[model samples]
Target chain A: MTHPFGPATRLALVVLAAASLAACASTKPAGPVAPRGPAEPEAPYRPPSQPGPVTQEQAPGVTPGSVQDFVINAGELVYFDLDSYTLRADAKPVLDAQANWLRRWSAVRVRIEGNCDERGTREYNFALGARRSNAVKEYLVSRGIPASRIDTISYGKERPLDPGSNEEAWARNRNARTAITEGAR
Target chain B: MFRTKNLFSVLLAALATLLAAAPIAARADIVVNVDQGVTQPLPIAIPAFGGSSVGGQVSQVVTADLQRSGLFRPLDPNTFVQKRIDVNLQPQFDQWKQISAQALVTGQVTNDGDGRLRVDFRLWDVYAGEQLLGLQFTTTPENWRRLAHKIADAVYEKLTGEKGYFDTRVVFVAESGTKAKRIRRLAIMDQDGANPSYLTDGSYMVFTPRFSSNSQEITFMALRPTGASIYLLNIETGRQEALGHYPGMVFAPRFSPDGRKVAFSVEKAGNSDIYVMDLGSHATSRVTTDPAIDTSPSFSPDGSQMVFNSDRSGSPQIYVMNADGSGAHRISGGGGRYTAPVWSPDGKLIAFTKQEGGQFHIGVMNADGSGERILTSSYLDEGPTWAPNSRVIMFFRDSAGGGPRLWTVDVTGRVTAQAPYPLSASDPAWSPLLN
Candidate 1:
């Protein structure tokens, strides 16, 4: 594509942005996340990350930027069916994609949070949530991620991505989400 | 139940004749048939205790306590046939009988001018022309409601053969905010929903505050950013200590009947197992080593056994085991899914939550696992707690499209009422009757 702005114009805009960077957060505010619904498994999903004949060299500490990029672009969540922890066909690909991304940037430590819909008993849902998180961890380990790199917590039905009580919303709520906890120095 | 009462009848009959011939020692027995399926609530009359504002408040509290039990109906004050201007005057039995009140309650209140309250009340059988119970309590003004509960308990025990549960308290997780960023705080209140107070700030997410059977303490699961773990809190002293030092997540905790041990589930490598921690020694022992999820461990009343929910059979089912964790047996046969199995205090029944066809129910089965009867059904009804008497179950009912709120159902399966809470609440733990 041809240059949209002239050099002089770009320089002027850059100077203005640098001047306002410190106060940008005060000028702009973030809004609530939009509603999400029952999600179908992603297509062209990669299987769990696996090691080759020769072990791959481990990556270093995760960079915050790359971790954020993985969460935003590579997908950090996998959904589950009602009261179930066994991953679905669609879920495999999404998890496969997650495993591939984690393998490529192996230094990052993550905490897997398993959550459930607001239906089962809180205590029991907690166990179910753990199973979901552990299921994801097992898949990632099968793909070559070090088991030590991943920790897990079950939020049970206590936390939900979608507050709606409908099945569509519950589907969104029943998910395992990964948060980048430690990045390389 | 009636046979136990019959044991006292023979002695009472002899005493009744002696008392009748000797003009009595200042009391009379008031008999009211109180048993399961006693459909008609006994009609009772209560007049103001000498026209004081405190008396009016006490009477109102007492009336609500009785009515909430689904056993006694307090006559409307506006329809009272007699004036209550004199606290010392005797109640005219015929006047109460005229209003068809089977029982009469009259009381007096004294402020004592030192911020202490003195409450006296008497239960009279109007039709029988006899007084059943008389009791007096002196307490601080701030504990006026407790006095009312004590009076109600006295009246309830005299009429019903069972000990009263009115003088009780409940601990629960009071919730607020939305589904995404929900806030939960530990809360406590009188069993009748009065004197509600917050025990914890909403900073940490807390679930399942279960009362220790032997004291003013509770064991609950607290979720923090670091990890999910179990905590033992002295509700009275505000002392909190971590109950487990496990590196993995620990949740779904309950106190042993003696309160010396706490049974909880610990999740490691995605597998949840049951563990018992002896509070005195702080030593933990694994109860279940299975790979399946085993949680919601409730101690049997006698501490000899425990009932918990497990999915070893590929589905969550109620299982019973010795307190030391041997001899696992499935007790929930008539099920779709069963979870949260709590042993009733009387040891005769085990209460649990069952889910089938997308609906949840609070149900009970005999101790041996036969005769499963579903109690209340709704979009979600889980975590059934037994009243100290085991005659009632309190649980949280989530409306199909709304948040959770506290609800209660008696064993009769007929009386279900919302236990009022200012905010959304769940996982209620009813305390044992206060001494």
Candidate 2:
């Protein structure tokens, strides 16, 4: 291969160059053609910058994103006394913790969905569950979390924590749960 | 001679008095409360739809149509009287009377040799010894079964004094998955839970599906990749469109009886309230005004009044108001939390989920919220929807182990049975008669 290209390289290159120029001249407009440009070097790829966790004070809306996350991580189910929609005294520690979390993560969005056991009328139990969940939300709001970050819904007896029929199941069912969605910062 | 004269006199006097009382009783109709009754279903006798050689599958359909009502007990064919063919023309009062049946349905089907089927049926007040109603239907050969259902409907409407729900469909949430994240699909089945097919996959959580009276469209809540939105999915075309998707959550979607509007909850800035949107105009009217949480709105069959779940009572209770949001009254009394108030088809009762202590149950009461009765017990039983007949209620029952299953019960609290399902199912919505 080296012998074949070396000897005839100059003569073949001249003939090939003439043929290529003729082909280009045939395809192009008659008068003039711009000189062929030199190729430019390619640039290397760079990674994108990572986003930082939303800060409590920096997040939009009234409630902080960190506080809402803390409340969510701690747990969403808040309990009440038997047959009562009022938030029980025992539930305050959890509510206080949630308040602190909301304080830290003010931009986070949450839904306080009220739920109930398989004991009452489905329609009325919905209202009761709403009452319970709203009660929890009001407590959090009073403790300095903006009401806007805490949306309330009543699953009533639709969704339950425990699907059992026993007293423990009932106790677990008579409560509210929280869910987080993209609306949170 | 004296003793013979006395016997003849007694016999003649008894016959005369019985004949005289017959006309008065026949004029005075018996009032049967079709909606309210004992667990004992009404016993009706249909003697195989006797005819001369062309009954052709009509009797079986007629019998099934009445029996599936869960209100009528059709007598066994084997117990039918000899020569029931003659009974169709004119039921021998004594023969039906002997079986202790209250109502007798007899029909004759004949092919006129002109590519037409003629069905004539007579409903007899067996006790009264007279025909209550009779009609004749002529249709194509393929429409014999429909004709039979029509005849049965007439008989049912006459005897029960209420419209029949035999030609209806059921839409329910076919559920599968764990306790934390339940996957639910929308499924449609015949009123008897037959011919079940999925309308949508359980890709996301779906809730509170309701059928338009035409049975062609369904309104429900679904959480899509974008967010939770209320969607009206056309049952026939498999097309879906989002309805009123605001920045916040919108749920608890229910259609008005007329199917002209839908009432749902729209949450903005954490406050939830009931809003009704006219399907034609896309204009929304707020139906509730409290700072408290309100959702789950249901319209009465007449579309004049609405019942919804509200926490305005400090505890959750059911409240009823005029469709315009006037005359608001708390229908649910003290003792439990209530939710999901579905108006009965006949506009007599409201079925709802009740929670007391720690347990939840499906309960019902008069539309005024009196005579509240609980119909189910479980770790979680909710969402009681009336069967089209309004005689039975279907609801969801869940155990701690797995997904919620569907069950149905009579108003009397007896005859509770699990609704047949290939998968765990819940959130049943009954459809009105199709066509």
Candidate 3:
């Protein structure tokens, strides 16, 4: 059998093989460097200790340095409209930036904390939180990051970042934040 | 012949001794005239269950339990003329009666050397002026809330002539994050929704948390980012192990009455079925083979039968089956959509969420599906959990335009409002009687 292969094809194949080999080499590096302390000590980057891909992107309306501070200090808060569980367009650029940073580091994982405003009962809030977290997972998956790298938990309004009783607080309370763990490859 | 005659005499002597002791055992069966006809909340006084090295905080929890039941009108501790809580110290009945208190609860607490707290309490009938029951147990100081609930159970059983529910704990999913990328955490709390602590952070989706029959472990559906599976979590140690690694989603889990088995719903493709697994062996068996959505399985107190919500009969309805998944029968008669069936602790009634005519209501019926009586109604009411006494239910009702709120009702359908939280809350699961 005769095969038609151009130089570009050969070059692309070379790049693909190199990428896979790089991935394989990076897989085992998590053990020794798994303890890289996050930038912020109080809310240190305790990434998922498991192996997976990472990516980070700056979200729209979120200043580049601002998201880093959000992840480090007071975690990022995602807001939602009434009766809706999908991420807003404004949230994409922020999540994409996080996904980009997540992609660069291997062996590090993120904790997707789901929360809802005090609008529903405890159990319903529980279900609602699940829906929100699942949305984040699905988005990260769409961004080419492996699901194993991300873990989710819903606070269900039990832990509020803001304890005020106004629309701004409610809007701020309805969100999910990502915590980058320490072990980065 | 002489030896046989001697053996017969010895047997006769033992029988005579047993006959002499029979009346003594009978005398210990304390009797009190309790009127079942009255459905009013019973008025009782629970003195600060004393014995705290620092401040007696657990006593306040006990006070809260009695106050929430709507059955007992807790006397104000501030107005008490005299308060004595030492277990060895006798309560002044005349002083308690002056406040119109019908029942009194008192306890002593001591921190054990091994980081455990010891609590001993007694429920006294002030009207009868006698100790009705005495209870003692040891737990960590952190478990003082549980101790208060245990005290409430003792007082409830003594006065209401029914089981007390304060000893129970609730397991449910906890949430945080945004609607898009939210995190769902597993959490457990006291029956009153206090002392809520997270078991798992939202690294995954957890649903339908049900306590084990022994109240030590919990079974719920956890969807890992990689795959969907159910998980069994221990409440005390926070250890979680995944359940059946199947090709699809497994959810709506409940423990068998004996706490030895777990029953849950597994969905493959578009079809859902009920399956039971032996917790010890991790062996699973299909309970329902139909293509319909058969979920929400609850076991009878004897562990012989199970009641679950199924859609095989067209709309969602209640169904019962044997432990081995044989002899399936429908217990919910013609009605609206019914989900979340919880068998009564007494093995007499099944409480469930009934949706009739667009609105949701909490209803209870006999095991046979007869005599269905709705206990609660609201624009959006779901997740009906029964108290240990089988006389009351605690559920979340979403008020119109406002957030979801928690409410309780008697078996006869009288509603008593509970203190609402600032945020939305739902899924009220009453814990087992504590002590």
Candidate 2 C-alpha lDDT tens digits along B34-68: 55654567777887665645563676666776675
DockQ for each model = 0.30, 0.08, 0.03
Candidates, ranked, TM-score: 1, 2, 3
Going through the candidates in order, the fraction of native interface contacts each one reproduces equals 0.71, 0.18, 0.00
Supply candidate 1's per-residue lDDT for B255.
93
Candidate 1: list runs displaced more than 4 Å: A1-65, B1-35, B85-88, B112-115
Candidate 3, CAPRI quality class derived from DockQ: incorrect
**Stretches of model 3 off by over 4 angstroms after superposition:** A1-185, B1-39, B49-56, B83-92, B106-123, B128-143, B177-182, B224-227, B399-407, B419-435
**Predicted chain A of candidate 3: TM-score:** 0.58
The per-prediction i-RMS, to one decimal, reads 5.4, 10.1, 10.6
Q: Candidate 1's residue-wise lDDT over B110-136, tens digit each?
A: 876776677766777776676566566
lDDT (10s digit) by residue, model 3, range B1-435: 001112111211111111121112212123322323235556667666566652267777777777776666677888787664667666888888898877777777887688677777666667667666666766656556666666676666656567677766665544455433446666666667675666776666665677776666777766554445778876655567888687544666778877888888765533567889998999899988886667778889899999987667756778999977789999888668777888998899999888777578888899999999887777767777777677777777765445555677767675456633333445555556433
* Model 2 spans with C-alpha error above 4 angstroms: A1-185, B1-31, B39-41, B50-61, B68-71, B83-88, B108-119, B127-129, B136-149, B224-226, B357-359, B371-381, B387-392, B399-405, B409-423
TM-score of 3: 0.61
What is the C-alpha lDDT profile of model 3 across A1-185, one tens digit per residue? Answer: 00112323554676687788789877454446466676664766788788766777433232333334335323244677743567998888777867776666555676666677754433334445555766777788799889887766555554555655457776877877665544532
- Choose the strongest candidate by lDDT: 1
